[model samples]
Target: MTKKGGSKHLKRLAAPAFWPILKKEYRWVTKPSPGPHPLGRCIPLLILVRDMLKLAENAREAKRIIFDGEVLVDSKVRRNFKLPVGLMDVVSIPRIDVHVRIIPHTIKYLWYVGVPKEEVNLKLVRIENKSLIKGNRLQLNLHDGRNILISREESQKYKTLDGLLIEIPSQKIVQHIPLEVNKLAIVMDGRNAGRIGRIIEIQEKPGMSRRKFLVTLEEASGHRFQTILEYVMVIGDDKPIIKVSEGT
Candidate 1:
């Protein structure tokens, strides 16, 4: 008989570079089960607990902790150890009072930044796309597989790449930050990944050029550079609504 489904195992060498695991020391690593985020952009909950958070000594311990309903993703209990935890997702362990939000890193593809107790329920999600849906409502597709419905009139206020501050679980939109000049933004990918700065200028081209829309960003250090609009995520208007850096 042929294999029925995808492989349950992932070789360490084949794991994502952002995963902080020994490549050669181990033959196989836990493969993230299909979830909201894609395999390349998210980390398995088991690996996150055991390796990144250092809350568990081994896979067994991590599984135990997760099975006990001690782990909460987005303010809800998540028992699946293979659950994918991706960007802007909150992981909380009430017992240990641990809370962290995954964000883009300059070196690693992703990194976890501590979240304050008060802000644990808040999350920032980018508007990947939007379209008209049933009832003539506009549906906003967020980066993390979430969809928000709004009235057609409200749709005019939002655009792709805009950031929405939402309440987890409830998912109520608290604020919307547009991607415009003078707005604070972060590079989500490319060579300048994880760099946060203010948008200074936007150059939109008409042709099929690879760089169709380039945005110039000025960092706090007074350095300015241009990157594709696809790589830029508006974080705030002046300063970031939340702490995105370790120092901040």
Candidate 2:
């Protein structure tokens, strides 16, 4: 296929899995259009950026370099997330000593993996091999040499314990906050204080807990802040509802 034709193919494959878009904006890039009409011919751009960052040992440091004006794209300083960058775009980073050429791609999962047929972004955006070794009794491997494992409960569900339909998006439960959106349950010393709050974000701190859920917990009643991951839940809907404390 010609270069132009190849781009069109990549766009079709990547549009649904990565970027949340309904229709292709190929017309937009090839023609004149308005703000954010979706990447016209930059399907490979997504793969390039993702791969570049994935190789980085420290994502925070990488982000700092990207935002600190140390990176250049196509002989120009490019920081904007939305650009018509394609597989041909050249990315230069001074601090990390890396140059990236974007490529088109698809989502990857572990062995015995399958995902929902829907086009929604997979919940687990990233998973490395042997990341969940030793059955459901082990923690999740952060792939960053971190042991940010989920609780046995969360692991069991992710391992198809209750026959929960595991989707890519659902895998992202680890990264996403345990909020009402994902049916996250929070407890303190075996006490339920309502479905605390919505999980908004997760931080994979080095030398800290494997991955920490940064929650916007809604305390129907209880103490503020507690040791996380000792016990938490992001198992999705139909979990045991708990708000009333024991012996209350």
Candidate 3:
């Protein structure tokens, strides 16, 4: 019988726009199927290990390392080479004592940020959806494709686009940072991503077909930029709840 379902190979030129690979370098690349993150926003685990991180020379080596039970994503060993590792997902190689968090890169649309081993358990998830469930429980749908339940009263304090510092495995929310002016934020999408800044102003334009909000971010170097509200993720009130320094 002929094989069916998703194709394993994708033309390099036809890959998603977010893919950082050079289209002319190779004719084909692995197309990661739907996993923990949306297809357009994620890269295959093999590509991340072999191409981006340069940890392995080829796909075979990457698979070997994964199958050896040496690769952990969000604190759980992941053997699937095609698994999607997207925004804010923690990838750790315990054997090498290397840990990284995938974030929007200032140059690449998405890039990996080296994180301290102690902070590997910390994750940032944006609240994308919420709904009331039975027993007065409120279900929150995070951007990471995770569904977590919180009390209705607690849900009332959270809104879409708010960032949460959650602990891995336990999935406990350590802090809640609201989206507002003067708050520390990070660009979660677009070219300016991974840049830490503070919200200087929020502009809501009226008389538009759909309501739109734009935020002005002032970087630590006294530089400023603007981005749509959806691109910003609140990280803290006074300081980041999790360590985000490059060397940390």
Candidate that scores best on lDDT? 1
Better of 1 and 3 by TM-score: 1
Per-candidate Cα lDDT values, in order, are 0.91, 0.35, 0.84
Residues 144-214, model 1: lDDT tens digits: 99999999989889988889999989989999998889999999888898999999999877785533498
Q: Residues 34-135, candidate 3, lDDT per residue (tens digit)?
A: 777877789999889998889998879999998898999999999988899998899999989989888876767787878887789999888987888889
lDDT for each residue of candidate 2 in 1-248, tens digit (9 for 90 to 100): 54543333333344434343234544221211122113442332223344335533343544455556676654467555334444223455545565543322222100011112231222221122224456555554421122345656655334311112122313333233222333544332123322343344444467774424333333335334433443244433433231111211
Point to the candidate with the largest TM-score: 1
Clashing pairs in 1: none
For model 2, the stretches where C-alpha displacement exceeds 4 angstroms are 1-15, 18-40, 43-52, 55-63, 104-248
Worst-scoring 10-residue span by lDDT in model 3: 204-213
Rank by TM-score (best first) = 1, 3, 2
After TM-score superposition, the amount by which residue 107's alpha carbon in candidate 3 deviates from its true location, in angstroms, is 0.5
Whichever of 2 and 3 has more TM-score, that candidate is 3
TM-score of 1: 0.95
lDDT of 2 at 181: 36
TM-scores for every predicted model: 0.95, 0.24, 0.90
**Model 3 pairs whose backbones collide:** 116-248
